[model samples]
Target: MRTVIRRTAVAVTAASLALLVTACGSDKPDAKKEAPAGDKGAQSSAPAAKALSTAELEKLLVEQADVPDYTVKADAKAKPVAAAGSAKADKAACQPFADAIGGTIATPAGQAVRMAVLTPKDSGKKQSPEEKALAGLNALKSPATRVLLGSYEGDGASEALNTVKNSGAECMSGFTVTQDGETTKITAATPMTLAAGEEATSWSFTMDMGGGDEAKFNLGLMRQGNTLASFYTFSLGGSVEELPIKVIDAQEKKLA
Candidate 1:
């Protein structure tokens, strides 16, 4: 079971790298740019493309052929819940961490969101209950290596980027996750290197489940055009390393 978690975590981390790389390619409009008053009418006459709907955004996600040696499966669809009551920490200050699971700024409204999980072709047999539970926590677990991809379309990519960059400092302090009435405390969160995306951020954190059990988390975020993608990977009873640079390179080429 421990082995399964590690493998799944590593796989997801790679996928997360891909998502981040995808976001890096497109340039963000300058936040400070303001059109001349005289040109406002002309600009209004010709508008940007209508943002893709959630369904269209999902269709644009990287496919199996985009990532070698991995089988990409779409995650089961579910309703979006309000980003509240997902977690609680010993310190009230850490409550924000619960929002981590609530979907990123990239998440679009309505039911058009799409997500996929990537597992290595050689992942072997079925996963045990322990593995399922951990994976269920964030749906990033599998017997084989796994990576999760979630995409949403909206004209808010630039807005999302600003939100993440601004809120990251506060959220990094760490907190606890509460689900199914059970609590797991995350004691630390360290920022990871993220040089690929137009706007990207990564973090590694330690989750303490009491009784000597612990898990590590690696999370990455990226934004491109009107889309935003988020990646999450977890290791149970093990350490998680930084995502590889090649994963991003390969994914960026596919997006190109």
Candidate 2:
């Protein structure tokens, strides 16, 4: 009877060992399996963050500035939608301005600035060429800011400066301009100016990016009734980029 009991105990021990080995082998595959349904919700809701694109930033800035409806041209006889006052600043404006300035060139990683403008709505029957130009500034729906990569020196310097200054740019000295590179930068919270009376009460400035890339750009902000406009221009390495300025509110600037 004692011998019979010992044999039975040995047989039981062998069976237990085999079961344990099988359990361990099965666990390896299960460990590699995907997570259960319980975890799916958490992963789907949290996506990686992304930086804002240039177009996005421009749009954001326009919203902040509160731009109004504007027309481009000096002919007062032209109506806002008819002659000189026609041509709303829209997404279509981006490609044309970009094309005019050779938008294919590379801009530095952080070389963006904001500017705005405000002017009374053209209530007159006729719009002038300058009025149409100003209107062109307002039609842009994006952050029409451009990075000045380079510009030709010599004869074009004064011409470029005058062209910019005439557009309500406030001159900033102490900034450098270099050959074959970027030189200066400007930033703003609103439009620059319009007809002296609309000049911005806020402050704007220029900074050097170091090396041969010396350049200058004017940031502007202003209010035309409830409307606002932002614009800028820069000279770099013999090239100039005139960024489109946009009116955010779409309301026409009216005279008081």
Best of the candidates, TM-score: 1
Q: Residue 157 in model 2: shift from native, Å?
A: 31
lDDT of each residue in 1-256, candidate 1, tens digit only: 2221222232344344233221212111112112233111111122224466557655555556664433344444333433334444455544434444444333554222223333422233355866544334432232122222334344455455445445546556665555555665667777665544445555667766557876675655554444444555443224445443333433444433
Best by lDDT: 1
TM per prediction: 0.57, 0.21
Q: Residue 135's C-alpha lDDT in candidate 1?
A: 35
Off by over 4 Å in 1: 1-49, 76-97, 104-107, 110-155, 171-173, 244-256
TM-score of 1: 0.57
RMSD of 1: 11.3
lDDT score, candidate 1: 0.43
Task: Encode model 2's per-residue lDDT on 160-214: one tens digit a residue.
Answer: 2233333323233221222123222322212232221122221123334445443
Candidate 2 ranges with C-alpha deviation above 4 Å: 1-49, 55-66, 69-117, 120-173, 179-256
